[model samples]
Target: MSADIVFSDATRLAELIRTRQVSPVEVVQAHLDRIAAVDPKVNAIVTIAEGALSAAKEAEAAIMAGRELGPLHGVPFTAKDSIDTAGVMTQRGSPIFKGRVPDTDATSVARMKKAGGILLAKTNLPEFSYWIESDNLLSGRSNNPWDLDRTPGGSSGGESAAIAAGMSPLGLGTDLAISIRGPAAQTGIVSLKATHGRVPMTGIWPRAPRRFWHVGPMARSIRDLALAFSQLAGPDGLDAFATSAVPFDAGVGTVPDRKLKVGWMVGPGFGPIDTEVAATVKAAAEALKNEGHHVEEVHIPALERDFALDVFNKLHVMEMKPAFREATAGHEDQMYTMAKTMLSLPDTSMEDYIAAEQAAERLRDGYATYFRDYDVLLTPVLPVPAHKHGITELVVNGETVDLTYLQGATVPLNVTGLPGLSMRFGTSREGMPINVQLVGRWQAETTILHAAAVLEGVSTVRGRHPSI
Candidate 1:
C-alpha cells in the first residue's frame, strides 16, 4: 500500500485523497518513508520538510470537517534547493551559503502550496545551479536511481532523481538552457519548461542571465505537469518577465479538435546524436503520424547557420560571470568546477557578444518561420542517454564533442523563449531512459503538452520505474 501511494502520480493521489479512499497523512507519510528508505542511496533529498506531517494532518482535518479542499490538498511535492521555501534551508548547493533560509517562498513554491500541495522536501543541485550534473561540495552528489554510478542530470538533477525513484511524486525545478529538460530525459520522468516568462522566477538564485532562466514542474506524469502549470502560469508581479496573463488550458489529455502538423529532427541544427536517440525521435514522430497528425522530417536553416549552443555560450558567459564572481568573492575555495570554469573563461568580446545577439534573432526568426506551418517540433532531449557521473567528454555518432553538447538541442528553446517539454519515449540498450523533446512556438505550451499526452497514450514504457 505504501509503495502504491508513493508511486502514484500527483493527479491520482489527489483524486484518491479527495474521494476519501486515502487520508492525507497516509499519502504524505508514504513519501516520507520512501525518502527515508531510498534517499541515502540516491542522495537526492537535501532536507526533509520538518512540517510535512503537520501540514498533512491539517489537510486531513479539513477533509474530515467536510470543508472545501484545493486540487492538491493531500499531495506531497518537492522543490530544487535553489528555490526558496520560507523557513527551509535553501543552500544553493554551495557551502558559501551553508544554512541560508529565505523569509518567503519563491513564486513557484508559493503557488504550489496555494493549490494545496504540501512541501515534502528540498532536492539537490549543482553549485549555484550552474552545471549539467547535480553534484556540489554542499550536498555531495545526486546519483541516478536507475544506476547508482550514473547521474540523473543537473542542475535539477536531484529533483529528477527524486521523482524517478518515487521519493516525491511532483516537484519544482528551474532551468537555464538544458537544466530541466536534460535532467528529465536522464531520469525517465516528465517536465515542462513552459514559454519563457510563463512561470515567474522570483526567489530563485543567480539572478544573472535572468532572461534564460525558467522555473517549472517535474513530475511522474504529463497530467501532473498540466495541473501544476495551470496553477503556476500567471503573473507574480515580482518577476517582471512573468507578465504573461495568457490562460493555460489544463486539459492536457483531451484530443485537440484540429489535426496538428509536426516536424521532427535529430541533427544538423543540433549536434551529432546517438543512433538510439535519433531513432527514438523518429519513433515519437511516427507515433504522432500514426495518430493522424501530419509528421515530417525537416530542418531550420538558421540553426545550421548559427548553433544555438554557441549563441547561448557567447551570450550567457558574459552575463553570468559577474554573478559568479560576486557570490564566490571571499569564498573562492567554495566554488565548484562549473563556477571556476565560468570565472576562468575569457570574457565574451563586445563585438562577439553583439554578433551572437544577431545570431539569436536569426534562430528565433527561423523557428518562427517553421511554426508558420508546423504546430509542434520534436527533437531528442539529449544526444545520448544518462551518462556516468564526472565524465567530461562524450563521443556521439563518430564525433567527439564537449560535454556541453548535451545542451545543443535544448538551449535553442531558451534562446527563442519557446515552450518545450521532456517525456520518456524510449529506453537505451544499457537500460537508461531516453526522452524526446516536444517544442512549441512561444506561449503555445498547451499545444505541446496536449501532444505529449497523446504520445503518452501510446508509450511502450509508460509505467516503468527504476527498481532502486
Candidate 2:
C-alpha cells in the first residue's frame, strides 16, 4: 500500500475509487494491513471481519461495471463494538456477552454498508459501555496511540484510537455523556455528536434513556465527518425517538458567507480549569477572532443556577440501573466496580425522577435562550488530557476533582440534547492531546462543522498521527 493512500481521508479515497485511480479492494486491503501491523499495540480492534476483503472485491466489481455508487463508495471504516454488526461478535468489551453475535446489522451500520463503506472491524469500549476508560474482561484494555499508559477516552476510545493511528479514516461511535467527543479530543481526531434522536440508535447496547444517547461519525477530517454524516443521519424507523426530523446540510465544500458569532467559556461553570487547558481553548478562540469571527467570553446562567453535577448523576444512575441489571445479571463477576456501584443505587422514586426530568427540560430551554444570541458556545472537552489508566479523580490547577468534573462542561449539553463537536486544539506540556468542544443550536451540526473546519485549517495539530 502506498503511504499517501494510507493517510488520505475518506473523501479523497472515495474520489480516487470513483475515478478508477484505486480499487475498493486495494483500499480495504491497505487498512487491513495497517491494522494487522499496529492494532496489537493499541488494542483498538476487537474483531476483524473475515469477509471484508471479499465484500471489497464485490464493490470493485460494481465500479468496473460502471454502476452508480453511494456517498461513501469504497471507503473503509470501523464501528464501536456496542453497535451490533450482523455475524460479528459484539462483546461490548465485557466477557458477559462473550461469543454473542447479532443476526442483523444495527440501523446505522446497515446505513454505512449500504453507502458502500466496508466495515473492517468492531472496536473496543468499556464494559457495557459504562466508563471513561475502554477496558473489560473479554477484550482487555484499549491503550492510547499517543501514550499506551494513558487512556483513550471511552466508550468510543477504540474507534478514536484506530482512526487516529490511520488504520481507518472513518468510524462510528455513540455518545451518552462524552463518549465520542472525549475520545476524539484525547486522540486528536474530529467527531460529531449529532442532535439527540437525529441518528437511529437501534441495535446499540444499553438502549434506554434515548434522550442522552447519540450515534454519529468519527473521522480524521471535518469534511470526511460531513461525508459520513450524510450517510448516517435521518430516521431509521426502528428507534422510536429517531424522529422524521431532517438534518440540515453539513456544507462540506461551501465556505461560510459571513463571520461566525462564537461564545467562549474556558473553565468549568462551577470553578476554574487547569492553566494549560484554559490556555489552549483561549488560543482557539483567539484564532477564530483573527479569522474574522466575533468571539467573546460568555457565561452559562443555567449551569450556574442548577446543580449540574448532582442532577446528571441522579438521572444517569436512575436510568442505568435497570438496564445494567438485565444486561449483567448472569455475569456479575465480569462487571466493573463502578458498574456494580451504579447498579446498587436505590431505585429512584417516580416523583423524584419526574422532577429531574422537569429540571432537564428547563435546562434545555435555558440553553435555547442562550443560543438565540450566539451562533455557538465553546468550552474545553475535559479539564485534563488523557489521564493515567484506572485513575478516576483529576487534579486541575492544584484542586482535586473527581471524574464527574471531567464531564462538567460536557454533560450539560447532553442534558440539553444539543449538538456538539470535539476536535484537537493543542497539545499539553506533557505531550498529551488537548481538545475543545463547539456546541451548536438544535439540529445545527453545520455551524459546528464550519467552525471546526476553520479551526482545522489554521491549527498546526491537524492530522498529527501517534507513533504507536
Candidate 3:
C-alpha cells in the first residue's frame, strides 16, 4: 500500500468507497499495512482484530452489490481500550483488567460500526484511564509519534499517536478533564470533546461519576473529526446522563458565510500561559482578524476567582473516590503511585462538596454569559508543548510550575460541560507541536469546526506528518 492511502482522511476515503473508486477491503488493508510499519515504534495499538480484513472484504462485496451503505462505509478506525468492544480484550492499561472482555460493544463503538466504520484495533491509555500519560502495567507505554522520548498526552495518548502516525485515519476517545484535547494538541492532530453527555459513556472503564465524562472523536483533520462525531453523538438509553437525540449538523466542508465574532484570551482565565504558546495563540487570533472576523481580547470573570480548580478538584475526587476504592481495593500495589496517593486522601466533607458544586454552577453560568457576546473563544490548549515522558515538573518561561498548571485552560470547559476543539497551530523552536483550543457554547461544535478549518488553511502547522 502507498503512503497516500494511509494518510487520506475518513471523509475522502468514504467518498471513494461510496463512488466505487476504492474497495472497503483496500482501505482497511492500507491501514493495517501502516499499523504494521508504525505500531512497533509508537506502541499505540494494543490489539488488532483477528479478521478485520475479511470483514472489510465482506463490506466491499455488499457495496458492489448496490446495497445500502452507512455514513462511514468501511472506513477504518481505532478505539481507546477503555471503550469496550464485544469479544475483544479491553484491558484499559491495567493488569487487574487484563484479559477482560465485554459481552457488549460500547455505545460509541456500536454507533461507529453501525455507520460502517471498521474497528481495526484498540489503542492504549493510562492505567484505569486515570493519568495524563499512557503508561501502565498491562500494555506498557504509548510513545509520541514525533519523538519517542516525549509523551503524546494521556489518557487518549494512544489514539492520538496512532492517528498522528497514520496508523488510523480516525478513532474514538473519552475525555474526563483534558484527556482528548491534551493528546490531540501534543500529537498535532484534531480532536473534539463534545458537550458532556453528548456522547454516551456506557462501556468506558473507570465509569466516571454522573456527567463529567465524555466520549468524542479524534482524527488528522477537522472534517474527519466531524464525520466520526456525527456517527457517535446521540443518546444511548443505557447512560442516564445521555442527552436526548438531536440532529447533528456534520458541517464537514461547510464554512460559515458571515464573518465571526471571536473572543481571544491567553492566560488570564487559567493563570499564566507559556510565552511560546501565548505567542502562537495571538498569531492565530490576528489571522482570524485578517480574515475579516471581529476579534478582541476578553476576560472571563468567573476564572478570576481562586476557587475554580479547588471546586473542580473536590467535586471530581468526591465523585471518583467510590469507583477508585472499588477498583483498587485489593490491588493497591498494581496501581500508579499518583492514583494511590489520590485515593489515600481523607474523605471530603459533605459541606465542602456541596459548596464546590454550587461554585461550579456559578462558573457555568458565568461562561454562559461570556459566550452570549462571542461566537467562539480561543486559548492555548496547554501551557506548553509536549513535555518529556514521566517528568512531572514543568518549567515555563524559566519558572518551575506544577503539572496541574497544564490543565488551566482545559479543565474549565469540562467543568462547564461546554464543547471545545483542539488543532495544531504551530511548532516550537524545538520542533514540538503547539496547539490552540477553541471553546464554543453548548452544542455549538459546528461553529468551532468552521473556525478551525479557516485557521488550518492560513497556519504553518498544516500537512506536517509525524515520523513514526
TM per candidate: 0.99, 0.96, 0.96
Model 1: per-residue Cα lDDT over 35-65, one tens digit each: 9899999999999989999999999999999
Model 1 alpha-carbon miss at residue 221, Å: 0.7
Give lDDT per model, in order.
0.94, 0.85, 0.86
The most accurate candidate by TM-score is 1
Cand. 2 Cα-lDDT: 0.85
Candidates, ranked, lDDT: 1, 3, 2
Instruction: Report how far off residue 370 is in candidate 2 (Å).
Output: 1.0
Candidate 2: where are CA atoms >4 Å away?
Answer: 250-257, 268-272, 349-352
| Candidate 3 wrongly placed segments (more than 4 Å) | 252-257
Pull out the clashing pairs in model 1: none
| Alpha-carbon shift of residue 362 in model 2 (angstroms) | 2.9
The per-residue C-alpha lDDT of model 3 at residue 9 equals 86
